[model samples]
Target: MAHKRDKTPRLGVGGELWITADGRNLGSHARMGLLRAVVEQGSITQAAKAFGISYKAAWDAVDTMNRVAGEPLVERRPGGRGGGSTRLTERGQRLLERYAQVEAVHERFVEMLAREAFDLEQDFSLLKVLNVRTTARNQFLGTVSALRAGAVNDEIELTLPGGMRLVAIVTRGSTEALGLHTRAPVVAMVQAGNVILATGIESMRFSARNQLPGTVLTLTPGSVNTEVLLEVDGGGRLVAVVTQASAEALALAPGLRVTALIKASDVLLAVTV
Candidate 1:
């Protein structure tokens, strides 16, 4: 097979990530690169240099990942004469495989944006790196502000730094289950449809939609669902999972005044609207 020119890179979407959709936060790009290089070179020092990180930093990342993953992704096997060489475990191999798969999709998505979202450079005026997930599952993150007890679920209100509020109905038992309370940082996870997108002067402005001016931060092409990130004022950000066709039509970008449409329905309203 003919090898093609190098292309595509995965970047972190600013703010909030659902682990279900994003794989575990075992480590980030540099860390993964370091791991792969270490496995290839069989030396932490060489791998660290290959990835442009210090030997100690690389070692730290590996240690932290091993700690968080609850499994060793790398193993050191004694070499005949050269002391020892490093190799990935079955667990490590699977981790690398999943990472590679996600990376391919990520690169492909960036390419899709460069083509489909041409105005992104002009449309997006702001962006920030909030978090990255190994999985792309539905999730939300914010500071908990209010909580109410109910017959069934506890209505918990999460207020984002930008003055946006999200109310979630968690079972009273489940609320107790999570031991949630005010001022607590929480992440909300739901289906893709749970998130909505809107532009200016649209009749479909979600009452739950948090309005802000932003540009198309990024667009990643998904086989079935495309992902779009919008950067809002004051470094605020949000992600919209929409069809590729829609993203092309709206031409969402960085300097554009796009309202992040979230349905109060998807998010509970703690106070009367």
Candidate 2:
């Protein structure tokens, strides 16, 4: 007998977007959930694991979010033995309400599109990676937790938070120039363009150079622009802003799958956090 088929990933739209009153976004789907969890659960650690993310990444997402908004969405007391509880300020709660309204509409729109896009069983792929660029993708700090030499290039692997790891291709000279070593921390960033989005698949999985799973933390709304937040797995966050129309087209939400794309050229390495 023949087996059943799997669903293809398709972009969905028609959801409500949650943004701060001042117009700064919190983060994207999962990040938003994490924010809410921090409020509901009372700790970043709890929220992170509840969402299948790492504690550091959750707080990192929160920190970047705080920086972006010019306001602290989550505030911590910082001295309880069991740890203080996390709560969303008035701003965070309001943001969620608005997001839900938009989400309902956006989901319906995407559902309609899915019907006509193609067979749900069609094989389609989706992925997210991490990259950073400053002077160039060439100059970045990276760790040397593991290495394998290939004829043309050596495969260098580094450990990152959120249980995330990064792999790089470099020549012996380049590796030596940077002095890659074990237990050393490096920064990783990716160019935005290397990231791709596809709609119609029920679920998404990625195996690119580096993929960080983050929560849709917040959305910043502007007359012409929209910012999306992603709270990564290892206590890191990503923010992407684009046109309002594009936000509508993507059907972004507060509890969506947010993947950060990393490109070799866009990734920047640093010795420090």
Candidate 3:
């Protein structure tokens, strides 16, 4: 008689799992795996070696995980004869166990799903439809606060979170075709190149239709241009691309206050649907 194989052949899908707490990512497979290794190895150094990662990277991952998880996943032990050791806390053990259980169930579900025949091309098309990419540097999700329809064009006032408003100009036909109305949700996009920044103004006047005062958040300098990010009052942000020389002349840095100006006509509007 011929010998038989002990395990049956099975088809399954493999993927990594990332967990989050309250919309903040807590940790992923590698980080959590490091936690488990630390528990087994009884030291972070050994765990890092086993994982083939730097000690600093392992420590940083642990710190971030604990911070984002809102509790300590690993705790340091008091120094002993050898040295101070690192071990996973109770929460870490529980998290690892929970992840193992979920992974088992997910594997089973995916195997079942794979057994069912489906059109992969159709699914790929749906994925493409769901992903929308745009070059505009500033995009805000808001609701139409007011609508002014004229003979040829329509003026829309969009209210963002924290009661900030942005005005956009579009043709009347486009507005109606997009089903845009008061209180309707829309996203406003403005290119960074279209924004103007100003600072140290006491009594200056400008013709820009939209003037937003905000604090400089970041400045990224490139070859010839610099990208400036400002946090607006209430809740919003504006990005401006300016010459590096201009950034230096203005002395723009983090926490320095500035105003972003954009013409209403430059604000592009889009609907989710």
Candidate lDDT scores, in order, read 0.63, 0.61, 0.83
Show model 1 residue runs off by greater than 4 Å. 1-141, 190-193, 201-214, 222-224, 263-273
Candidates in descending TM-score order: 3, 1, 2
For each of the candidates, the C-alpha root-mean-square deviation to the true structure, in angstroms, is 14.0, 21.8, 21.6
lDDT of 2 by residue, 53-137 (tens): 8888888988978788777777877665866567787876776666767777666556655553344443211111122225321
lDDT of 3: 0.83
lDDT of 3 by residue, 23-134 (tens): 9988777877898899889998999999999999999999998898898989999896998999888988899889889877766655545543243322111112334578
Top candidate on lDDT is: 3
Over 4 Å off, model 3: 1-130
Residue 55: error of model 2 in Å?
54
Q: How many residue pairs clash in each candidate?
A: 26, 62, 0
Best candidate, TM-score: 3
Q: How accurate is candidate 1 locally (lDDT)?
A: 0.63
Q: Which stretch of 10 consecutive residues in model 1 shows the poorest summed lDDT? A: 125-134
- Models 1 onward score TM values of 0.41, 0.40, 0.52
